[model samples]
Target: MPEVELLLRSRRVVTPEGVRAASVAVAGGRIAALLPHSAQAPPGAAVADFGDDALLPGLVDTHVHVNDPGRTEWEGFHTATRAAAAGGVTTLVDMPLNSLPPTTTVPNLHVKQAVAGPKAHVDVGFWGGALPTNRADLRPLHEAGVFGFKAFLSPSGVEEFPPLGPRELEAAAREIAGFGGLLIVHAEDPGRLDAAPAAEGPRYAGFLASRPRTAENEAIDALIALARRLEVRIHILHLSSADALPAIAAAKADGVPVTAETCPHFLTLTAEEVPDGATEFKCCPPIREAANQDALWAGLAAGTVDCVVSDHSPCTTDLKVPDFGRAWGGISSLQLGLPVLWTEARRRGHTLHDVARWTATAPAALASLGCKGAIAPGRDADFAVLAPDETFTVDAAALHHRNPVTAYAGRTLHGVVRSSWLRGRKIADRGTPLAGPVGRLLERA
Candidate 1:
């Protein structure tokens, strides 16, 4: 038998060097070599040839909320990872909130891994929560291989994972910096939110008014300043306000170790587009106006925004009540991130290469997942076979997410994911259904 276990050839293979016709040779679940597209496959090796479809590195979504172990009703590893594979994401880093006992300690991390090990359909990593009382757990969790620490500048919705105040925020930063760990923050100023009038009723305008651009801007400014003074790395999560792009750019230029990510909901959906009773469009740092969305697109084109991820936070239907203030604030879009981004990105004259870079390359770099986000030698043989020209209308009920509700309920999107592979094994296919859970837990070194 040949040493190469599997060989995949594609006419439009997206590589770091750029898209070209190439054949990938796989051995021991890692990419062994890249040959010409028409190269002959060795004897006794499984071969698959995609004549016109584009081969892309599986996406790495760093911001995902798999509310499992405690709140499995909201979402669990089995459902979430299956949705991930169907959406062409081969690796994910779950957020540390809304789960039972949250990932605030080393023991909690183990509990999550134990539950996720058997159910996940894709490789998974975790982020440790940074609450006021969990300061002592930071170093231990990092040593335990958590990717980083997650904090909020304001009250997190769940009472279990409270937000970090100014003093506590600085203290956490110092502790994490002492160990050279990354601190990812949900930056929304509490004072600004408290000062804004209560956003009651089902009016989308009222909800949008409550979480104004000033709230996100002020919080990001504080984070940038804090990272500069403490000489620590900080990451801004789910950045919706384009008003803060200039400040972030200037700080990055000034050598402050700060990075930012914007979600697909903010980029595609807008405040004007959402109906009053559409609670699914309601998310923290609410989607802004079209002009602001334009600025965000410019930020992506100019490198001000580091990556685009689906902040795939979901809850049961009962949580999505009619009242905007009373309903839960999250968008369920894990299964549609790629096509959603592509539909809009291609409209803006962007190519699949740009999409691959933002969704795959940049995110893997952010989480420091070395083996993921590329189709080159020495990397995992994970790939997303995409028909860039093909299109489909999203059906929420047919999705793999536990809850059938989604923000992309009837949108027609481009770029169909024909198949997704993890470590040379086909885990999900648009045509063939998943056979079993073939995922493993990942850790940061």
Candidate 2:
């Protein structure tokens, strides 16, 4: 028999089949077996019994922006992964932009890995950038093991990573398809947006109106058309507009090989709640109204939206100017995604299993992280011990991210994460000091 290293027993264990009482045995850093809840641990195995607390598969967030290397002041690997571990996220795929000398080439990727390799507290993977100038660098970067390429259809905020033109977009799509890789896009029509009123003020309404849903809808339509024409896989990132749902559903039904994701802010917060001058709530695709939030929920239930992730883009607090339009556009919720989503999801009559699927399973499937997302045998021994009934108010200063500028400052949330384990080792426990760096840099398999 294989040497059993650890055995975790829980009254509520979430398996792919269903939630049930079970004991998970781990050996060689992978799940060895699923035994009955009362099963005896092997002689040499370390046992952790979490009575009544739910044991869930660690979440896989594929849209995090750990802007390290050149942009460590914004958010670095140590801070970001520590925040991730605290939120029950064992694995995260970092977006390629925001960092200086973005991951647009193999050498740049190595630079990031060199900085992150020793500081990461959880498993980290990278996404390559699809800039107009990097067209020739795609395959080499793919072969170097980036999960996929990320491209923006509109101004990317950072001048170095320019938005791809229509011709450039199609060319990148064809190149990515040629290599059988995926292209994840930030879909927003620049033409419509430039024509729309410019955002400029402390008023939230002006910012909301500046980025109307039609921009997202038009971009999705164009992307769907491109995906169909090129026979490539495309993923829409941080989809905040509900009006694009029907088109996404239709395209998927016709087998267009496309998928989309939304963030916790889009699911929980609303335009109606955002107070004036609260620029911390600003993001690229502005959060819509409550009815639109309802439509987004419906889209999730209807399988139009594939997953939910924390687009945990963080910056210095000073950068979040009182002006909504001029402030940095991102939300810092890396350490709060689980509880925030759980609070809203439970209220909507959604079960923990549904949360698991959206937060872990679907993201894992999207990035092809085959071994990282489930509790089944042969999967990595990553788990989150969540106390479902516990509750806490959000305190931005207490968060693990480098900056204390979260939009969830005073919100109360459910599902407290007591501890998180990565590869059979405890990386985060509520009040205890975290263990040393045990995370590995992952490559596409």
Candidate 3:
């Protein structure tokens, strides 16, 4: 018998290597130890044994778009973070756009913190925005503790956060490099975008044609070149076009500091399958054809793609219109990222280890959160007990996000998240949050 604060035992515990029967000991909100199932709990220790369910590390989503402060009606820290907790995500990094004052300056970062400090149900970190006008503010924002800076090479959906041009990209990269900060880019060339046919109507094909793979490839090519020349770290966000994989791979092979993250929408949904007039499936750098989707999975399996995150960018129902061309582009999947990814991954013969690495580990690494993603000593004891084979139909209205609009509505997804624990306490039960918000605002050092 060993003394510990709490013991969570499961027949299938997801470890770094793979799943096995283990008992995890928690003390002072950190995992104090991991022992075999035969290990006995101390006399005063409390233990919860999950018979057939799996004990998994709480997911760390690094690409969520919690449009708070100015756009709280769209999504806010309170609602979004609660949804994350219900979904088994104990940590998430919010994107810097869609809010009134995008987090391009230190003051803007402060504003975000003020809004989120008490509202977050799971630990929330922030990514700052990089616009041409804010080039001078990048260093201070980085020093102020943003995980990284997000820049758009093409027009950001919201006008407040304008995209960075080639010159601006160079300037921003230089500034970020000086401070040793990371820059995550929404890679789509405006030149190619201007050349593509004008988008209008309900045709999914027309929409897909307007944002082709060429745009992604062209933008990545330029960013990779610039990153190499400047010796700066660049991350490509929400990679939907598989045509850019070889270049990304070659860049990594050539020692360029570049990484890419693809979203659950791009991996699971495709343009060909989307019904006409369904704007819920709409997202920027729109989901491509089946072949492209397959290539993206290959990129993930081959290690060309660094990770998978839920770019859980959501808006009001009115914003995601019945007209595909008029709808705001984003997917509301904060609460379904794990299930969606698990359903798809298992279908492809991949293990839960892959899911843990992609959703939990890599995202934490991107945020520079050293103790949040894994189930090991010194790491935070945030975890989930999952019924991997259980199925549930998605009910958008039942979702905890402010807006009930979602692309995954009505879909029968595998892998039910039975309960989510944040720092050794259960925070989720059937989509309702049970805690009084134990989450903190994480500022990257």
Candidate 4:
């Protein structure tokens, strides 16, 4: 009766019918109606039309590394969520490690929520840590609203969160399975990495050689076998080895409860293109050759890769210096995943709808976020209005993240987010958060 609140019309609106001109009605922070361009609006409703821009469901990036609490100097909720808003991401799930106390216990999860309460500008959820010692705390953290649990098969690059051995991994998986929780893993085999040559010097090849495809494939094979025997849901994180794609496909075909994801760096940049000593391009399970990149994209096209979320792990500038052997192995692209993906995806003949599926819908499904991720009745009014054809050069200093260190620093990218709305309210462009914390700690159903 109150004029239905607002109407946002766009030339390209991603919907069940595909991208087309449509006017969406919003009321009480949810989509009230989706109508044709010429349809009448509810009386007195305010309207804003994006002439040539596309209106997409705000991206749900489930793999951001907002190292807050103890490591807020690296990244925090305030800066990370502001970056998310500008990047067209409306919802993000924070990784458990890097933060002090990590999100292993129920008390630690509360510490994270309390720290993030007044700072976040976009909707945020969390993942729990799966340290060997924390498996006993899994059910309690899951019950307390953590989306799922994260573990590593190799060293986690941090002293606080160590990797689990095969037996420890199975034990943790069993605990998670007993609670009906999911286990997301950083699947690089320690044994294979140990067998490989040590990475040294400035050459990217040396670094790439240290973490080979066999490391990923071998670790994945173990995970697949464990998932089948343990009856647990397992997701491989930041998959870079294309050789493992067939194994993943076969496991899925055989009904193993396993899924995998790849980051933007893997899909956009290849080992051939990376210059020696460019530590910014360095990441674990290092970016492989162009042929491998093509295979990773093929995996996405064939639906073997479930999602394309930015594993936006960032650190200080000093940590990402020119020395490849000593620098941190992560990329900071939380605010640029859309444009980076769009630039490469279009050249490869993929659509924005595919981008939406990879960046928004699929990630939400993986995290079990029911109200976020899509444009539909009863869903949160989270949306991104983009000038899909606009191009912009990257300037790391202009970004909202705490550290101005990013791999996309000089590259040009397509797709610009003109505006973003969260639960019927515009943020970043205008207005402060309505009241208290808008993000609710999410849980999987």
For all predicted structures, in order, the TM-scores are 0.99, 0.99, 0.98, 0.97
Residue 222 shift from truth in candidate 4, angstroms: 0.9
The true-structure Cα RMSD of candidate 2 reads 0.8
User: What stretches of model 1 exceed 4 Å from their correct place?
Assistant: 431-433
**What are the per-residue Cα lDDT tens digits for candidate 2 across 199-279?**
998999999989989999999999999999999999999999999999999999999999999999999999999999999
**Residue ranges of candidate 2 with Cα displaced over 4 Å:** 431-433
Which clashing pairs does model 4 show? none
Which candidate achieves the best lDDT against the true structure?
2
Residue by residue across 1-445, what tens digits does model 3's lDDT show?
A: 2348799999998888788999999887889999998789876789999987988899999998898899999999989989999899999999999886788888888988998898889998999989989888888888889999999988887889988888988999999999889999999999999999877788888888899889999999999998899999999999999999999999999999999999999999988899988889989889999898999999999989988999998898888766777889888999999999999899999988888889898888878899888888888999977899999999999999999888899999999998899888888876788868889888895
Ranking by TM-score: 2, 1, 3, 4
Ranking by lDDT: 2, 1, 3, 4
Candidate 1 vs candidate 2: the lDDT winner is 2
Note the Cα lDDT for every prediction shown. Answer: 0.92, 0.94, 0.90, 0.87
Tens digit per residue, CA lDDT, model 4, 292-410? 99999999999999999999998988888777778998999988898999999999999988888898889988998888777777778889877878899999998888899888999
Query: C-alpha displacement of 353 in model 4, angstroms?
Result: 0.7
Q: What is the lDDT of residue 114 in candidate 3?
A: 90
Count backbone clashes in candidate 1: 0
Residue 269 in candidate 2 has what lDDT?
95
Off by over 4 Å in 3: 1-3
